[model samples]
Target chain A: MSPTPTTATPSDVTPARTGGGRTGGLRLTALHTRAQLLETVRVPIAVIGTVVFPTLTMLFFVVPQPFADDPAQATAATAQISLFAVMSVCLFTYGVGVAEDRALPWDSYLRTLPVGAGPRLAGRLLNGLAFALVSLVPLVVVAWLLTAAALPADRLVLTAGALAVAALPMLGLGLWIGYGMSTKAALAVAQVLLLPLAFGGGLFLPPQMFPGWLDAVSTWLPTRAGRDLVVSATTGADLPGTTWPVLAAWALLTAVLAVRAYRRDEGRRFR
Target chain B: MSAPLVRLAGATRRYGDVTALDGVTLDVPAGQLLGLLGPNGAGKSTLLQLVSGLRRPTSGVVELFGRPPWEPAARAGLGMTPQETGLPPTLRVREVVDVVAGHFPDPVPTAEVLERFGLGDLARRQTGGLSGGQKRRLAVALAFVGRPRLALLDEPTTGLDVDARHDLWDAVRAYHRDGGTVVLTSHYLEEVEALAERVVVVDRGRVLVDGSLEEVRSAVPARRVRVRAAALPDLGADRALVDGDRHELWTSDADALVRRLVGSGAPFADLEVASASLEEAFLAVTAAADDRSGSRSATGVPGTSTPTTSTPEVAR
Candidate 1:
């Protein structure tokens, strides 16, 4: 039997058109962020790994040290560990997460949507922020309980803002690796890049104690720039003259690389 | 009249050296249900992707609602489920449906979509824990949540069992009943037969036939003649196959062939003549096109390589 031809009545089936604009884009971003966060939280190990590792490093290494006895050194150590937390969130959330997502068919579906990339990128940024903040809690608790770490209320707020700002470069770097490489390659690259960045940035040692040559190079690294900005904000220490510029340069470079990687992936897969 | 829901004019897509879609033209009017039938590597998926705006044509024009499909606005009324889709493992089925629904300005209720797809019970289950068939169902369900004017489904029921496939077909039928247009590709000819008002048979990146189901079924106008005879008759058949004492001949005019045999005084014990089925017609159409193109390219068709001879399978 032939199918009955039914005319499309506007009231019956016309879809509501949310024109792709700033407001719709923002709404989509919020929805994406909520969904992404729920997915991340369901995997307890992912959150635990990012949160526990940095806190444990501080508890086992920094709290027992004699320098942690001094309020200034303790505050600086806390700031460094917090920076480490932010870095962990950036690398794990965007690097490994994005790479794994790229391997899934859901990623292809999302990429083809009319809402464009704003929602996905913003959602990822929001997720990174959530993980970064969550990772800091344990470190803050450890610092408060076992060490002489102290920060004025206003400085605490400033330190939080500075750490977030500093994380931009790391997030961009993560995106570059995620979009440009396979999941396995991205995972290995993230691990390989993480430790060297942390060590060279003086997250494990004071910049003042670094040899002259190492100190000069460290001043130019984004991680070191981030470390100086956060430590100075919390402990009132002097920052290198190039700290802000170094961070800005790294952020700009990685952002460009990330965008290029995204376009390249899009062209190769969808074109 | 409004513009066609989808229009492709001489659209072609090439991947490296292989052309996935050759110069071809097609138009799907609103509210029409089209089934794209083809063998493996026949470019059905490629054609669907072009309509979905997931890929651009290397040359020629592709439009949705009369606008260039590359524009996001052109794709606003389009929904598609590709050949493969992996749902987020950690998200519950309900959550996945809801999240996808949220993208539309006004979407079908999540519960209603799940219920329609027989996924109500699995709503609370994590997508990763669900069976492959369940995942496939969910993926197809998500495509309808937005109430799109046009839907492109590529092998939507590949992993579904008989019942599941029927249930999915009911959902598609209801959608078409409501005046929704759809273009679906599938390996199951029965699936196409069940849902498609219009059928397009594609092979080797080109369309071999396009018509209504009945038109396509009779497209070849050929019949198969089977008989048991002690001696093989010298009949002019396009093709013939022999199995023991039974002989089968394929010809466009079965009546004439039979009369000729009877006149020739061939002693035939049993004889039967039957019109070609949709399956046979499909094979004949593709095979005839392949033979024509293969011979043409053998002489000289620039950039054309020798066509590989592989028997078409229903499941592929």
Candidate 2:
């Protein structure tokens, strides 16, 4: 028996047409970002690793620090905790995920499509931000109950600002790791980087607890600056003005490196 | 012709020490189904990537729809189902198709694309759980969702069963019927023989043959017949012969020799006839080139190392 050809009425099938310039780029970027987010957030490993891990570490250490006296120290500790969450989610979560994805052929496949490097990077940034947001839930709840940490109106805005700025460099760091390192090496390197960046940034302990030499070095690090900014914003405390510039510099430099690594001849290994 | 849907002018790609595609030039006319045939390292995949705009050529240029293939307009007009099993395993079959469709400027409805590919029932099932053949089918369905002007499929039927392969072939026929051009590379000669209007054969970094099926076959030497006869015949006694066998008959012309056997009343029981297939012709061409290459290397002649075999011309 011959198969019958199906004819379509105009209503059954939409006519294909060119999307306008802005609409096309935006829609493509949205699709790419959504896919990136879903791919990351849907995994149980990411949820446990990003959201739960940082909260668990904070509860173990911060629950013991008394909020009764020296409220300034209590506030400083809260800022440090928030920075820890962002670091784990943005750098650790995003890095490992993108590394595995790079190994699996996702970049090659997306590059073949109409998706550009900019939109692809944007989608990943948005996904990292979303994951970063979700990771804050436990930290916020735990900090409010245990410590004298309260988010004031302006403080909340500052926290938002810190997250936005901090995401830029972490996103760049994650992409660089994804494109620059081999899969096995990336996992090991991410673990190594995650621990030092988190612990040394005063996530486990305050920066003041460090020796003079270490504290000086920590301030120069992106993690230390990020934690300082978050703590200062969340609490009505003043941090050094140098903190903002340092974080910004890290963001800009890492972003350039990430883009360079992505387009590098050595990065085209999936084929 | 208005313009070829895909055109390569001296396109070349190389890895540090190895060349993938070397100065390949070809035009895939609009609405023509062109097949790319080659072995694993024959550079067919590289050629497909160049045409699909996945990578820029190391030298020369590749154009699609009369523009650089990587441009947004050109990309929107092209669709590719890559050789690697690259789809995210966590995504549902339906979501995968829908997501790929969303990348296009104006894509076909997701429901129609799914139903057409018989993937409606598997819509909610995750990609990881799908069988290999099912995943391949999903990849193909995703490529068609955009109604792209040019579809580049690399080893599209690798894991398909017979029925699935046939189903895919039907979909391809339907796609071509809609006036879309297709450039497909596959190790499956039968698939190429069935689907492609024109075939391009690549060996190493160069094109060994490019023409219609008949033209390729004509370029190949005539099929040498081998028959296990009770008694063997003498050379020139059978027209033309390189060697003979006591119980084997050799001839380029099978039918003429078969008639002669009946006329001369030769006793024969166990008889077998072997004809050269596209695969055989491909191997013969490549092997001969290798022989010429070795000979040139031995004599230390740099320019004459690569043998150039002209394909038999076909009158249009």
Candidate 3:
């Protein structure tokens, strides 16, 4: 039998490629990203990790605590919410993302395609960033509109801006944990890391409410810096000048370690 | 003649202290269907991975059309269906093909690929829902979507039934007919015997035999000959596994001692010959090579050959 011929649909056929460029590589990266999106939508467990758990926490915070009579309630509340956002974006997203990556043969298969390492890395970063941003919306709005008061508009903008900048380092650091640790270890660490970082970073309470030493340490924590940036954003409180620098350093260090760890892990897993 | 599509020149890949592929070399030219047959840990998958550029060789080089194997341009003319199922389960059959097709500069239409593989109805079905044989066929279809110059297939027929296996064999034959080179690795001796014109037998990270199947068969001196005789005549020194009454005796060798049987006036009648099966020859060749390497332990690791020969494990 003669083989059946197939006609090209207009949408299916793009302009014929005449040049030898990195276009195929780019397309592979795009397909990977598309796959990531489809998986996020199709897998309910993924939805919970990315959206539901964080949203529930947002709702929890927006509800006023029973002990509103406490003298330092406002400062404590702001600190608590900041901690929640940071952990949600950094540890939760990154940790779960890593576990998800481990479950699939994405890294191995992608490495084989026309996709260069750079594009694959870029696609992942974009996905993580997108997920982090989506995670912020519910919590950010709930914390702002639902709460009686928040950092003033100008401070809120600055603090949000600062938090965004701070998030870059946390993202990189989270990648280090995700890439370096096995899936089981990552989950355990994420669980252990989540509670302390949240409580210590003062997402549920203000760091100032703690003793001087505790407060001093919290200042160095990424969550602490994120909280301070948020507090400064809303209340116009003066954050330490070193806050940005510290976050920047953390980001740089983590990025380097993360790249090394990911490359090493990929090399071993593929072999 | 066109240049060889894929070449492995002294290819070696090491995993820490262990060598996965040890100075292995082969050429897969156009219109050639080459099968890499070996027991488990024989470096068949490693060779396919090297050809696909999914992994690089530790020392020697793997080239496609004179370029390094990993180059996108080099891989453009190559198709690979890995030993493990690489297709995403949740994606529909069409979607899986489309995803792979997107990687190529010029990909065949998804519908055409689906129809060619008899997967037109399954196009809308998720890959996870397809049966194993269906999945394997889809994988083959996806590999052929770009009309690749060469194909690297690892255990391509792991779960197919007899009919499906024969259908896939036809597909492979058709692929070779289209001037494509195929490097297939399978545990199934019959699959390799039927599909491959050339066989490359590997054991313990080394190539034991690389030539036409007939030549590999001839390497081991074993062929079954059936003859009718009223009385048995064993004149020569060759060992014989004979059965049946004096009216007939079956010998594994016909050329050497069977002549003596007729010379002795034995009632040698109704003579028939059975060629030594490729499977038996493969095992014998592998056994001899292992013994030469002193790998009697059958752990399938090179340079660690033991003194007491162990049976070679079948490739999974």
Candidate 4:
């Protein structure tokens, strides 16, 4: 109250009315990402929970095993756990994150601002992806140090591409859970869903050991499809014709469910 | 002054069968510092939500700045603080302000906003570390960060201590003096008396009174007379409240009530009279409406005849 109006120079802050165009929208999206990521990483426990488990899995389970020196098996094992890292980050980040944000009055206030939901939504997705990428670093470094998880540069790039593309379904599922449930429900759902997708989809164990029936079921799971897609890229194994289409199908279906859940949440909360 | 900044025509909002806002029509001309007065569940917050375009009306028109309230362009000049809000717990106070400011085309520098809200020192602290009063101030401060033409503040000072409340009032006044429009709702009558150029009283999702402060006060002309009395005669007042050694009575004719006390030879002293508190005035009007319609939907959910007793039970 002691301070009166002190209009800083026109250049002092973001110019008003600039949010109408594509550039301004991009800027706002980046701003949202920065703010959300800061809010997230400031809580050290959250970062550790999302980022550490995958690295630890690779360390205790993969690095010290016989597959650690076999180039093909080691590459395949590294690819599988990388998928684990991405899946863990996405599930908790979106599933738990969205539900928690909805309960925040800050979230509602942000919605009331002139910018529509596009920037904030895009920012959250980007923020999650950013963390997923970061979570992969320690695992990759450890795989390089302790395992013969060697791939030609081109194959490594291809494997990265495959993993990135395959992440869509998991991202969609996370969003679906986040928008559809309360925080407590989302946390339970994420936890319950993660292990089955890992073990059944063969992220925890290789599919070579699966009996025919489990293999049949695993092939149809999005996680298994994702695992095959990335593992083949890294190992140069025969690619299945159904891999891309299966991931695409899961992605499309979950995206629709997520959007519907979001609309329903809005109706119940404020409408 | 060119046109009403906001106009609501029979606007209604219903959560399934329970209508939060009834068919209410009102116009807020530019530059009016409006105070919305009501008890719990009176639709004051709902009305602000409609005007701010956070929720759509079920049946009627709600316009802001001559356009649909939901339009982005229409919201450019608007700032709002809902009755309940949350700040991201882990975010530093300045970062939260900056994030909200980023949405506006032109915003006051984050520093200036924090300073004006008396939050300059707390800028680096995470919002989770703030006390209730500090949090409320920051919440209110976000509304003015954009230098909005219209500020809709819902219970901005609800949790503040008197000095903090006064600080917020000063921030609001400075904005209004610069020709900004403000619409705020408060249970504190002194707040309305201090800030509102025009006042609107709402009850049962309907507007009971909409006029200058003077007109609303006159319409419900009950004066509060405070006396220290024991074993008083039956000098009936409109309503009376007792606080141990003090008896506070509301009556339009303070002179007559005092005279009657003397004539009856009731042992009373330390008599004082002022305008009836808005709480007293509001209950009298709502109670009168209750009696006219003979409806139990007045102050207390389960109807009772005692207006003074019923109001305090609901107001807090």
Candidate 5:
């Protein structure tokens, strides 16, 4: 015969206390982020596919160009590529990742827990952020080592802030796509949206090169708004007056859609 | 009745035309190892889903710790293992345990939890690498990591070997001994017999019997009756089938069944009867109930056809 102890005793478990909400939520978020990151990183393609292309594009196209020696052009190019890196990482991570998680029964189990979706959402955001930062490293390093890009430490700091702000819409859009679509659909949408956003935003080619119609239409896109704000910050160029409002509007729209999609996604599936 | 830890007052859930849970009212006090015993599609999963807040009842009240089960706060003391849940394939078992344990205020050490569930050796393996039985055990173990007041397991030892099932039963028993309440659902009468002090048999979206294990056993009969008769009348056996002049019946009261058989003047012979081991009786009881209800009650769903009054199907 053996005497074994259970983790909880009846007397101690009388709705006495829930995990301290503020601290416990934060801790749960951290753990979720850690778990998501571990799972994602183990599949190298998930991280590598997002990080490699931006750095490769910079090395092959921008760094070899004559504009490689122009500080303004070089700095602007660096910022654009950096934005692409953030966009890709955020979109694929959330769009593909969230859809993948949604397809899992584990997700249903997690949703059933007393902890709401807050921690999981926060954790996923953090996971996307980590990869986004990682994807930026190679492109930024190429810009610094091979190009005539020059900026003060503060300017670099400003680029980071602009990049973070620029990442907001992509994050929301990624989340929206992730929660709203199945994995195959999300992967296709994330891929389909990537190049158009990059080209229209003048990330690969400057807006001055755009046709009259595209230049007019391009400015309305979130990617264009992000590029304008980031390019202005990096090159000391004048930011269009409409940039902030446009980006903010898209951010608001997509964030709301993402949240709503997530809340309803499980209900619709289980129903 | 110290205000039962879980209270479902006439909880009913309907999916389209299928009434998955039909007016089920039950109270579970703390520390009770209550088994929801039923056949497939007997609404066991739906009942657990209602209590776990995965799905709300279409009608009636479902409460955990006095609050509606749908509220996230009300789930604070509850843990659940759905019948077939996935483990994130790439993470090592230890990491998964630690991450889930992080959700609790006071968590069991990951290593200890692993050891208790015989998963210590598997701590470093990716969960995707685990065999089905191991994955099942790990899933069951995670429920205890949070030290929850209530654990809802929908067929926890489903894929395990008999040895594995026994090991898991001990772990569950230990948890119950320490005052953790368990509400497990299984189609297996044997499984229910092994772990539950209280048992509730559900069929066709209704609770057919609910009582302490001994009380249920004494009330339900598991006797098998075999007799050759030229003709047979309605003896009211829980289950009856005749094959080419040979009669087979499982009766709760074999003595009365015999008297009824002879008094009917059917000219029967070759009498034989046997009793004990509860599955036959349990199946008979549910089977008889199934017959009383319309055969369509087997699956209230609008489509799909399964044989009605199927004891074998129910046992499956």
Candidate 6:
């Protein structure tokens, strides 16, 4: 027979006195974030893909060119790639990850639990930020080794702060796509949208080389606005007058759409 | 006395044009092992979802521990295994158990849970690499990790082998012995027979019968008659289910039918009569309920009648 002492009866496993208080909720959120990070890290290919794609693009396209020897041009290229890294994390983590989770039965089980959505949503946001940060490491290393990209110590910190703020619209857009479509559809859409946004925002080539019509439109895009902000911080370039308003507008719109998509999905599936 | 662990009063859930659960009322007392038996689209999953607060009803009320089931506090002592669950593929079995167990205040240890479910060896393996049967076992085991007072299992052993099913049955019985309330659904009649103390038969979004297993069996008025004859005998039975040369009949009045059979002096060599099994009782209950609904629809009777009280029914 088992010799474990019976110190507590089944009834003693009653509801906790704290209920769903802030501390309990936060603790659960932390655990969820930790688990999600572990799952992502276990799949090394997923981590490598996000980091490698942008780093390779910088090596082949930016570092071998005459612009590699110019501090201002090299810094702009580095900033552009940094934005690319953040965008990739947002799209893959939010768009593909959310769609996949929705298709899972574990999602339904979690929805039924007493804990509110706060923990799970917060956990996902944290996971997205971690990947975004890791995604930048490769691009930074390549820039330092092969290109003349240089930033004052304070400007480097500023570039990071700007990068975080600039990633908001992309994260919102990812959430919108994730909640609005199935896994297969979300994956396709994320891929299809990635190239157009990257090219249109002058991420691969300098905005100075864009056609007149493209220059007019690219100035309004969230990606271009984000790039301009990052480039200005890192390269000491003058910030464009339209950059702040354009990025702010896109952030607001995407945030609204993301919230709407989430509510619509919840109403359709769980109500 | 305390309120029942789960209470649904006139709950109705509709999806656009489809009515998943129609004005249903039910009560599940503490420490009762209730089995839900029904074919597909019979509102079994919907009922469980409402009780677990995964889906809200369109009307009426669903309560857990005298509070709305949707309330976090009300679900603190509840555990559920849905019909289908896909565990996070990359996480190990042990990690999944630990993450879920962390949601509860006083959880059963992860190691003990894994051992009890025969998953001790697979604890370090990623869930995605596990076989279907192993995954199913893990899903069910997760329900007990929280040491919940009540567990709602929707088709818990649906995809398990016979041996696995029996092992799972023992685990369920052990949980019940420890004073846990359970409401489980299954399409397998044998599964219900083996474990259920109380059975509820649902059809077309309605509970056709609810009572002890014996009570449900007695509710059917038909008796099974088996006889051997050279050819088919005109025993004047209402319906016949035949196996080879033997004829099985369902008749309301078996004694009168048998008297006629003997008087006719037909070349019947062997005769046998026995009470109907639970399978037949289940079929009869569902059939009668279908007939009632069919006639009601034919008569153009609106389905918006007053909600019925939660009374155990011999027949719908």
Query: Which stretch of 10 consecutive residues in model 2 chain B shows the poorest summed lDDT?
Result: B295-304
Per-chain TM-score of chain B, candidate 3?
A: 0.75
Candidate 1 lDDT, A84-105, residue by residue in tens? 8889778878988888887776
Top DockQ: which candidate number? 6
Instruction: Give per-residue CA lDDT, model 4, range B207-258, as digits (tens).
Output: 7678898776655545878899876765667556667878877666788988
Docking class of 5: acceptable
**Candidate with better DockQ, 1 vs 3:** 1
- List TM-scores for all candidates, in order: 0.84, 0.84, 0.79, 0.86, 0.84, 0.85
Which tens-of-lDDT digit does each residue in A89-178 have in candidate 4?
Answer: 878999999988887777778767776677889999899988998899998899898999987887878988989888889988999999
lDDT of 6 at B226: 84
The per-model lDDT (C-alpha) reads: 0.78, 0.69, 0.64, 0.80, 0.79, 0.78
Q: Could you tell me the lDDT of residue B95 within candidate 4?
A: 95
Compute DockQ for each candidate against the true complex.
0.33, 0.29, 0.20, 0.34, 0.37, 0.38
Q: What tens-digit string does per-residue lDDT give for candidate 6 at B1-316?
A: 4457789899988776577787788898877889987666667878888888877889989988777777766777788874334688899999999888878877789999999999999999999899888888888898888777788887789889999999999999988877788898876767877888998876566776788866654454447788877666566664565566777666656898899888887777679997664446445434433454422111111121223334232221
TM-score of model 4 vs. true structure: 0.86
Off by over 4 Å in 5: A1-23, A267-271, B14-19, B82-85, B203-205, B214-236, B241-316
Q: Tell me the interface RMSD of every candidate, in Å.
A: 5.0, 7.0, 7.1, 6.3, 4.9, 5.9
Candidate 3 TM-score to native: 0.79
Quote the positional error of residue B118 for candidate 4 in Å: 2.2
lDDT of 2 by residue, B1-316 (tens): 4566688999988765567888899998767888888766767877877877776889987987677866655676677884437888787887777677777656778888878877788888988788888888878877777777778887789878899899999999888877777888776767887899898887666776788866654455434455545564442222222223334332345677667766667665555556654555455545544564332111221212366544322111
Looking at candidate 5, what is the lDDT of residue B180? 79
Q: How well is candidate 6 docked (DockQ)?
A: 0.38
Ranking by DockQ: 6, 5, 4, 1, 2, 3
lDDT for predicted candidate 1 compared with the true structure: 0.78
RMSD (CA, Å), each prediction: 5.3, 6.5, 6.9, 5.4, 5.6, 5.8
**lDDT, candidate 1, residue B70?**
59
